[model samples]
Target: MRRRNQVRQSVAVSAALLAALFVLPLLVVAPFRTALFGRETPVDETEGQPFVSGQLDGESALRVLDGETVLEMDLGEYLLGVVRAEMPASFHPEALKAQAVAARTYTLYKLQTGGNHGDAADICTNPTCCQAYIGEERARANWGENAGAYEKKIEEAVAGTDGQVILYGGVPILAVFHSSSAGLTRAAGEVW
Candidate 1:
């Protein structure tokens, strides 16, 4: 029937338009997002950064949950806060431990390399962020502990200090996008 054909055409057009609205913008935006994050991806590649800006980065900012402003926490503080005091017994202890280590390690790299002082605006970093931005070749070389071996030919960056870190500004050793199999935030000291 003509009605059926019209319906099919309507659905087809709707799908086409939806694809354009969604996929077209992504095509334009994804590379831009990578550039902003100090990374790049070919269209042929499957992986990519989803959002561009540091402020409205959506799930990327979820690591700093309920955070309207930045918090500066060092590794010693983080270790004492998250690892020594606050981890939950319900979670897989190894995974949680790994996250804690990653969070502390990455924070140090960020603080040392992002700038020499605490006054600059926060950089775009999260668990999924590339290791190059943290500006540490040492983190790449320390894969047994840092776990950045998957990264190929990491970009070189200047190391400014031995005590580089802040809770949100630091980089994580294990760089998966999602948080964990148990889905929980670390205790206040761990991340704050």
Candidate 2:
């Protein structure tokens, strides 16, 4: 009887230890999900998937707004208007009609990048590679007409818009949200 009790206790202890080892991974996975979402959140099943976090929001998504009428738009075209709107008014149709390089000083896509840091004309070493567009944080020029509180609102939400903006290869692409009247698009999405 004593031997049987010892064996039973030993088995229980081993089972408990095994269960803890397995559950340890579940605990670790918890933080990964938390980091992805930033918090525990329930998603709205009626709308769509809930966006979990900020970094994932800007990963390749877009936010849109309607001037007055509501409409769905392409992610690519929307982001272009943002980059353009976020740009100085110099990027307006009037200026877009002129040489893209005309307004150099305030222009977001200036031909020269200014000084490397109080040195020489900040010419790009590989303009053909990156197309040499420079901004302190891309540009305030990149934010656009629609105002969104969170980057997640730009992504998995905002199913409707006046327009939208998308990111490709870590670059912004803006396109037209033509609700029978088209908006903006670009050749390169980022450069043009």
Q: In lDDT terms, which candidate is top?
A: 1
In TM-score terms, which candidate is top?
1
Candidate 2 residue spans exceeding 4 A from truth: 34-192
Worst 10 residues of 1 by lDDT: 152-161
Model 1 TM-score is: 0.24
Runs off by more than 4 Å, candidate 1: 1-73, 79-89, 115-118, 121-177, 180-192
lDDT of 2 by residue, 87-151 (tens): 33333343332212121211222222332222322222222322223221233224333222222
Enumerate residue pairs that collide in model 1: 73-167, 102-172, 102-173, 106-170, 106-171, 107-165, 107-170, 107-171, 108-164
RMSD of 2: 18.9
